[model samples]
Target: MKILSLPALLFSLVSVSEAKKFQRCEVTTTMRKAGLDLYYGYSLENWICMAYYGSKFNSGAVSGSNRHGSQNYGIFQISSRWWCSDGKGKTANGCRIPCSKLMDDDLQDDILCAKRIVRDRKRRMNA
Candidate 1:
């Protein structure tokens, strides 16, 4: 078998590393857009971990046994019933996620909502 050139192998490794780094950079940017920078006060890794556990960073991170069985809606599990009343379920209006209604994918809204929650928690702790 013919041996591969070192430069080619090095280039491939560098490309993969760059791709991963870009993904992480995107996560950090999204976190900042979500107001995490002002509220969480943690590293991008922490933000990513928390959001992943919460909704896997999907805009429509709904969870439940069945599609219609008491399903929790949105990235933060806001609940479809409540979200509907808030005009968040209407696609034509201003709801970020038309189909999934997850809100996590909408980085700006997700970050703002998360920031609010983080701030509230901090207040509680200080109190």
Candidate 2:
């Protein structure tokens, strides 16, 4: 039997932790289950469209930096400028989470943060 080196083992674990791209139907189902079907008055189809365009249903997707020097992370492509902390720059951290967490397969945090973004947008529009 061969033993794996510590770095190799860690690398394997990290690779396993990477997120996956969900199918369109699967994304819709998940959104519905999370009570996001009609969240913020947006239909389920609308959310699906956003996710598709933003990350092509890729939960682990990370975008290149924008002109503002901020990058987007995760399925919804939440920006690091105001949503998440990248640990190397200043951010509002509205989601109060590490940017890396958004890249995980689990999407509960991502959904919550997305909801927060929508709510903030609604509030701003109302104001």
> Which consecutive 10 residues in model 1 have the weakest lDDT in total?
15-24
Q: Cα lDDT for residue 49, model 1?
A: 69
| Residue 93 error, candidate 2, Å | 0.4
The best candidate by lDDT is: 2
Error of 2 at 112 (Å): 0.5
| Candidate 1 residue lDDT tens string, 1-127 | 1356876777778722111112446767767665565354666566676656656555555566334433444444444442222343322212333324344334555454444444555441121
Cα shift from native, residue 4, model 1 (Å): 59
Error of 2 at 51 (Å): 0.4
- After superposition on all CA atoms, how large is the RMSD of candidate 1? 10.9
**How many residue pairs clash in each candidate at the backbone level?**
4, 0
Compose the digit string of candidate 2's lDDT tens values, residues 39-88: 88878887788889999999899898887788999988888988899986
Model 2, runs deviating above 4 Å: 1-16, 122-127
- After TM-score superposition, what is the CA distance of residue 34 in candidate 2 from its true location, in Å? 0.4
Could you estimate the TM-score for every candidate?
A: 0.45, 0.81
Model 2: lDDT to the true structure: 0.84
